[model samples]
Target: TRRHRCRTSASQCSFCEEYILWFSIAQDILKYISPRDEIKLPELELPNINELKQQQLKQQQQLLQQQQQQTLLQSARSSSKPKFTIEMSSGGDNQSTSSSLSLNNEEEVPANMNTIAPVPAAAVAAASTTPELKVENNPDAGIWITSQGVFYFKLNTLHIHLQFFYSVLKELDRIIDIDALYYLLCCLKLLILNDECLETAAKDNRGFLSYCLEKLLVPHIWKIFALGHGHLNECCVPLLLHALNYEPGKTALWNILERDFSSAHWKVRSSAGTRVIALYSLLKPKLIKNNYNVLSVLAYAFLNLITSIEDVEPTVSQKAMCSLETLGDASFKTVMCALEFQFDTVINDRSIILHRLSKLYTILLRNNSTIKILSWEFFLNRFDTLSIESQISMEESGELISPQSIGGFNTESEHFIRKLNQIRFAMAKTDSIKPISSSIRVPSHQRRTTTTVPRQTNVTSDKVETDSIGSFLSPETENSDRSTLQLLVNLLMKFMMKDDQNQVNDDRIMLKQQVTSNI
Candidate 1:
């Protein structure tokens, strides 16, 4: 009772003078962006000696550059500013240090000058040679060249190393110890695909992209397929799909597609699913028809594989939904026509259909440009077709579609209705064309925008787009805007009037049991 009264004043309490929270929080923040995650940088093979050497060399170079720049300004301020000078020194065990001034002044600096400073011999060698490749307003090329320069020079200089964009991929494949390869590939493909240097390199060297594809992606396709462990970078297939559409025949996209479609690995299989969307979307614009037979096989494979997983991880489920929604483009509608006849036979499982429904609902719930309305979007927007197909299953006495306790049909139907309206409203706003009839979708895929997926493209079907390539536009895509409006009145009425006398009977039985127990 007297403990509080006897307690010392607030500042007098025994407390350790520690800032663990701040330190721990700082550690966590660093963990979020730990440099170890980057694929471009090689592992630190050197000890503190290597690091110190680098630091010393950096300091020396800085000093030399300052002297040279100081010389340049002095000369510019004076009569003579011709000699551009840099410095280098020897490191541990005769390791030479080179100082490079990246932003040196424009005046021609000579290689030799005592008043300036001694050029690190290696620095002098590089200065005596050609300048590094310069990319003009192109990041991809710069990335590619920086990457290439390191490998080309065989200098093994880690700090001032090349960007090594393409070849870094090959190194990653060799070095990554585990399934990290997939994630690494994902990071790198995303990096390289969007890199300004790689793009510039591709533009500057017309054949460089193909060379990279052949070296980095093409050779590994078979190994990726052969491993069949279902481990693949989610970005890998889509990036390839991007390449396929980017220049069409510039790279061997068809090969990657064929391989992924046939791959036994579920991860690879799922990638194939999205790639199918990419293929159709890509072909839709050009009216280029890929092999329907292979496409058909992929469809069955995708559905069967999708349905087979009794308990799917959330990421897989989410990605599968995305892949499906992306399939919704007008091109997919064209493809689905051929697929509709087979739906009853191919997709009869009630549980799978429900699962598909749940996933479709999720995708539509999150729809935007990034989730490029692939065939799945086509299927969801055309839920009427799905319901018709479901009715066939019910009639066949093959277990009616049941949502696995995720939500009730009424809620789902309403969600579906709301999403459909969004699609319609979005179309109305985008097309500036009101529907002649409430049910009609707008002229489809006319004037489709050409921006690829973006950050926060969490929209279910993230958009897929191509750049700096031949433009292929679609006509049928415009038809999709017409698949408008909200809940189907008849369907809602059916749900409202659904027979549920079994529930009453069950309740009566429960009441009787309760009375008997009380007696």
Candidate 2:
């Protein structure tokens, strides 16, 4: 009974302490009120303090439990950080051993934490001497395609891969399996020509790819060109041709033309001509002016076109002419140079040469005033060297027309003047001189080379009188300089007919001098 009374007194003492705390809080609040206010105070009733003491004790215990749980959670987070471990073990069988393995707990921990299996002693022993198994990260790993079994390159190491590829490609010639080799070629076609592969991912690596193709693939490609009857030409040449569209592959393209234009297969030779034509068709003037060295080297390939122009095969020669014609007046200078060098050797083919010369001359005179003036200077300087029959023919044909007629220009000359005027007007409008005056400036070396012809005094009157028309003008260019020059000559003829004998002799001599000067 005495012990129970002591416990009740202890409980009462706890409630007294809580009551004191509440009474102090009430006093602090009343201090904020005004003393003069007539406010009525409500009757204060405190809860049974002894019972409240028990509830407060229970809440205190629950808070302490929550604090303990929080500490446990913090401890769990610390364990999750990287763990490093070192273990040493001694073994029996007359051998002493020490072994260790660092486990990344984050990855190695089992899902059922309680069920983690122990590492075998043998495994641990082996692991101690073994090097750390490194996992290398492949930058290109993302490009692997499993279904098609191909790797699309991201081009990070494209040059290195191409070097290795070219090395392997060099060994393909030794491969005994023809079928496998052919299949490899087909695979290369697809890999190198894929639009995304060529123009997108590998665009910057074009130079390396082009070099590889030239050094390794081009020899085999030439074989295909020579074999003309096979599917190889259709398959492989086109692949290399497509590559040539890019700047880097132009070397391989040029090599193909250089090597194959003389190919035994007529079809291959004709195809070479066609390719040259196509290449020149796409030429921009900027490229012609800026890339002079490359164009000079490429010009070596055009000699094949020149010789082929006289080839026995009409089909082949026609293709060559078509290409030469595309070069416009630029070809005029080249062909004239060639003719000057090879004229003696080509005497047997003179008619054919003359025909081609006439075509080129007419083409140039129609488009370029510089070539027109230069060619006229050249023909006049060489007049005496030509036969009398040839001279008369030229006069009738209007090929040797005088320059005085330029002011009273014909329809063709009028068209040319109109074009020149348009160019000048365009330049004036833009206030830029780059368009017309200097666009196709001829090189100084291509200007007319001076030739001296002795005066033609030993002439027959019949030779001067007979003017057999030559085939110089095409129907499209009807109002040629010839017609204009003829009109001038006709006026001189009537002037001679009306003059008296003494005046006739003087006027005739003057007329001859005028005609000679014009020529």
Candidate 3:
């Protein structure tokens, strides 16, 4: 074999050509996404042909009437005048003077000229009206007038292909290529950067923008995030925020956010928590308008945030805590309602329940404004009832109540109870002051009657249980100390029974093995 050198260069490669073509297409797409200036003209009402003709006829009639009046006046004046004549000097002079007099009479013909002047006014009106009629009749004039009194000069070329763009956005998920998807998203973002383009896209088809947002944009962007393409999320956030301008889009965006908040992935939950805070900031003004839908969404968001605060993942929990703080700073009344609503619902975890109640109490204490003392008193009464029920269950089970028995009970709950006692003490001290009505009102759906489950017992025992737990300060504080103790005792009893069963099963298995060895 003979040694040979290749003469081909990298610039001439097919891949290089493809890259250049791609770049050119990308540039063209960007240029296409940019909005072109549209010229809007004021609506011009065209003069009706029949109306113009009537106006001309009226002008002509008026001119004729004036001419008749002038003729009558001229005839009357001429009849009122006497005719006079003078002798000429010679025949030739008389002929010259007669020609000169005829020229002067022709020059003094202003009366006929005045009558002719009004005729052109009619002609002028007709001339002015003709162009408008011709404009109305002509096809090439490029002006269109709708019955709504709007004038359309010309259609934008981009508008013709808007549906195609929307379809592409709708089908964005079907695109598998990363570069292609990124390019498409970039182009879409550029399109959204132009307010006019967004308006046109919204008006192009009813609910199309919202459908794309709810079904396409949100899910796809979240999918990309799930696939580890976080940078794409940045590109999509602006589009999502802009979608808030549409009513359907607003609802759709909120639904997606609510769904994502409950996602199994911690990262998704964290992102949703942050987005919720941002959305609340954006919608704070609308919340003031008392829109029922908006308030409902806000209530849901608050509930999600509260749940996320107890998330196992630190990242998500921290985000939720920060979000709650942000919301509290913005509107305390809304947060208060959400807390109360959560408390009213079924929560299995005693620690989480106490944590939320403590948070609510903290909020109430921080609030300097006079709130309904009765609401606080009502909660205290409920706590007193729960404490009594737990004590009755504990006594029925014959479990001893002690600090050591509860496995070194939660100091946080004790401290929270101490704070609650302080509040109660303050209320007692202010017995003379009338309770102010609460400015915050919980929604109807959140309201429920507190009904106690009656325990099976003799009438005298039931009466004694009720009487023993009736006092707010002594029973609630005592129950607060022993509530955790009661919970631990139950769990311990269940664990002991489970361990005994397990040991018995193991012993039976060992005996079977020994019998098999002997055989």
Candidate 4:
């Protein structure tokens, strides 16, 4: 029953006895370290894999060759023997005589078939190898990660699982070996990364894993920061993000992210800003409720982190802007609030801030058309007078409003207006295309021109012509005339589309008629 047979100076024994011998030695060492009968930690060491591999390979080859040699010997013996049969009577005496004769024929061989050679014990003990892991608790049952099935743990009801979380945190603190900590992280990652394991854990109504995630993970986030330094442990990001998904942990997440956003290093700030945007993708109205607007915190951070659109470090500004784009409708409210309270002083001095703010507003409008409509109504109806008053104030104080400020504002406003018009025209074109499928038809004259009267009959006097030409030239009427021309152009485009469709249909009918006549 020996897994590894090894000969000692006094006697031959199995590897199991040697293991027991070494295990007792380990226990003695633990006893020496023990203080006043305290429980000792058992640290197991692993054996060298190369030695085991060589020993196993040699054993396999020997087994195969031995099997082959035995097969050849059996063939030789059968070939040497004759294939003759000896008839025997049913009586016991005749049967015994026949059996004795067969045995007498086998006795003619020189060797005894019942004997086996003794195997020499191997020096290497392959069976004694064990995994290299330390356990502070029971040695018989090793450490394992088991999920308590729960999506989240309520703070009041966490008494059932809180102790487990505390125990893990305490053990983690005691572990000074970086390798052990790394293994611990890998084990937890298996818990979160495995979809099947996660589902099973959740279904089993075990909340220990969820409690560790919700309560223990964030407070211990600083440990990762210390170990990883400036670079974040990529393994922890998924868990951190997952924690943020739960409603209870968002506050803690916001605090940690805010701290990083304000770090002395720009790289950390950049990373935090990137996460802000990522978290924004998961933001919902429900998630943003209860006086916790992740978007607003994110918006404030976006503005706080970057000096201007043209920061000394362009990447920082770019990251902030990228995070800003996911702010949804919150962008509109933030911008309006800024314009009312913060803009007048800051806007005149830093043109880059104005430019970035306008870019964010444009993104918001492009995504939500209803916001655009609301914005127009709000600005035109509410802010018109305020804007006029501000303009007057600027005119009065030339020293405050520099040429650079005016130019930047005009440039940013122009870019936003261009984007707005492009979106509007695209919507118009799509609407026109959809309506083209309608069956309604109009007379050619009516479709070609909205005016019913003939040009000659409706001829205007010289004064009327002069007035019309002068009105087109007047600066006061320029906006109105431009809008009027746009309307007319749109109408003309629709009429052209109808004409093209009618001509195509008529050509198809004529071609069919000609084919029928020829037949």
**Candidate 1 residue-wise lDDT, 409-488, digit = tens:** 23245443443333333322322221112211112221123322211132322232322110211233312211111122
Off by over 4 Å in 2: 1-156, 159-168, 175-178, 195-197, 200-207, 259-306, 309-519
**Per-candidate TM-score against the hidden true structure:** 0.25, 0.26, 0.32, 0.26
lDDT score for candidate 2 against the true structure: 0.40
Q: Which stretches of candidate 3 lie over 4 Å from their true place?
A: 1-24, 36-159, 176-179, 195-197, 225-231, 263-306, 312-519
Using TM-score as the yardstick, the better of models 2 and 3 is 3
Candidate 4, pairs of clashing residues: 148-206, 148-207, 149-206
Candidate that scores best on TM-score: 3
Clashing residue pairs for model 3: none
Least well predicted 10-residue stretch by lDDT in candidate 3? 431-440
Q: Can you write out model 4's per-residue Cα lDDT over 1-519, one digit (the tens) per residue? A: 123434554753555445445534643543354333311112111122344457678989999999999889878876875543343344567675777688666756555332122111121122124234221222123211212211223333434233323443444455443444544544444434432233343454344444444446754653564454322355454445444433334445545655664455667656655654443333443323322122323334344433222333457656665556545665445444433222222122122333334444444445543342122222221222223333333444562352112111332454334322322222223221111112112223212233222231223211122222223223433433333233223322333433345545654575455434433
lDDT of each: 0.37, 0.40, 0.45, 0.39
lDDT of 4 at 345: 22
Worst 10 residues of 2 by lDDT: 451-460
- Top candidate by lDDT: 3
RMSD of each: 25.7, 40.3, 29.7, 32.4
What is candidate 2's lDDT per residue for 110-180, written digit by digit as tens? 53253123333344445446679222222244232211122334434565434434443564455333333
